[model samples]
Target: MTNVASPVAVVTTMDGRRPYGTTVSAFASLSLAPPMVLVSLDDRSQQLAIIRRTGRFGLNILSTRQAALAAAFARSGPDKFEGVAWSPSEGLPRLPDSAAWIAAEVDDYISAGDHTILLAQAVTAESAEGSPGPLTYHQRSFGTHTPLAP
Candidate 1:
């Protein structure tokens, strides 16, 4: 799917008193009537295990300037948030300066191939004012979206 361009995001959850997260590109709006989202995670992802245990998570849609942050969380480790600035929102870790944020409760988990698809209901949603364009991944490189002339 390297040819497919996708928005970058970080899926965060609290593991006891510690915060954990992973970078993902497979997130999408699943529904509107009931405010829902779908996030796909590798079956072996530690973050997925946390979400299963807690039944909740926060999605931080990264901004154009957050490519480094995305790379940081994408690494396999527990220190992804070591120096990252964030706060608790609805009891979940919320990254600062993201393009958008969504806190959701897991409604179901669907197993597909090597990944688990989380069907979640959004409990809280927010968009930053004048945030930079969304961060994107395409062809194994980080980038951002640009509007075409009308």
Candidate 2:
């Protein structure tokens, strides 16, 4: 398995009422046969704990302009969503600037060394008016998406 995402993924879940840690990393689909996607979160992360207990999560594809959001979520974190602008639907926290957002139900969890693999079924989705591409994590820093020439 390769350790890279099509673009960095931002995972969010509610903490009682407030949104906590927006996790960003190289995440991708684990199985199309079963409609499954996986995200790797550190074992000690609050996001992992919330996902396990609530059994639901949202995957938000960040647009290139959302580099700050990506960095706020990706770097060594603590209350990552502190000042981020977002709203909630069915209790799922949504970042409005995301290129696309998908809501999912936890199907299973896999233990992979330092991280827990969250395998979930994408149940609902919304497409935002994106500026262009997505936020990419590469070379130990964050990168923005670029539009290719026709």
Candidate 3:
């Protein structure tokens, strides 16, 4: 049994078509000097094809309200973005009403074990005003984070 822990944001990458992205958790920031980040995608993942070919991707951060949406794409099934609302802006895939989103161009790709590390530059970001929680994955399921009282 997987142990549940602190939740982490669920992200969807609309990086490319051939290897289109979906729910991924191995997303994180790698540096801040020039603003760089890394997303770890499975080597065998269909997403690798496009990410490798195009050298660019989108990171659509999921809001807490999108737990179901996150789970929908996370689950083992096809047509992940079939009914999802997305558009190609600036020739990049973008999601509407996301908690926040980032567009990054691949800086470097590193092969590590079963996953490939995509080092990218944060191009732009968008978010809904006010504040919203995030959809997090811990152990295995989609869960919300409980902020500790300050």
Candidate 4:
């Protein structure tokens, strides 16, 4: 999937009083009527394990200026949010100034190869009015999308 451009997002949830998150590019809208989305996580991801226990999560769609944040969350560590700026929304970590945000509850889990796909129903969704274009990943690099002239 390296050739395919995918939006970068951080999946967040609370493990007790602490916040857990992971950067992911395997996220996509699933339905409009019910406002659902799909996020694929490694079977062994600790974030996934937390979501299983809490059944709730938040999706922070990173803006172009937030590529560093994405890289930080992608690492395996307890201090990913050590100096990060965020707040709690719907009891999940909310990153400020993101391109978009979605609070969701996991509706189902599907095992696929080495990853488990979380089919979630969006409980709330919002977009920043003047946020920068979404951060994207392609060819193993981080970038942003540009619209083509009509």
Candidate 4 residue-pair clash tally: 0
User: RMSD, model 4, all Cα superposed?
Assistant: 0.6
Write one digit per residue (lDDT tens) for candidate 4, span 1-150.
799999999999999999989999999999999999999999998899999999999999999999999999999988888999999999999999899999999999999999999999999999999987899999999999999999
| Candidate 3 Cα outliers beyond 4 Å, as residue runs | 1-19, 76-78
Better of 2 and 4 by lDDT: 4
lDDT of each: 0.96, 0.77, 0.69, 0.96
TM-score per candidate, chains pooled = 0.98, 0.84, 0.83, 0.98
Model 1 clash pairs? Answer: none
TM-score of 1: 0.98
For candidate 3, write residues 69-147 as lDDT tens digits: 7767666654677777777754666666667777888989999999888899988766667647666777777777787
Q: Which 10 consecutive residues of model 3 have the lowest summed lDDT?
A: 10-19
Encode model 1's per-residue lDDT on 44-107: one tens digit a residue.
9889999999999999999999999999999998899999999999999999999999999999
lDDT of 1: 0.96
Give each model's clash number: 0, 0, 0, 0
Alpha-carbon error at 95 in model 3, in Å? 1.9
lDDT tens string, model 2, 17-132? 87865656746767666666778888988788988999999898888777777777876666677777888865788887787788888888989999888888878766776357
- Misplaced by over 4 Å in model 4 are none
Per lDDT, the best of the predicted structures is 1
Q: What is the lDDT of residue 22 in candidate 2?
A: 64
- Between prediction 1 and prediction 3, which has the larger TM-score? 1
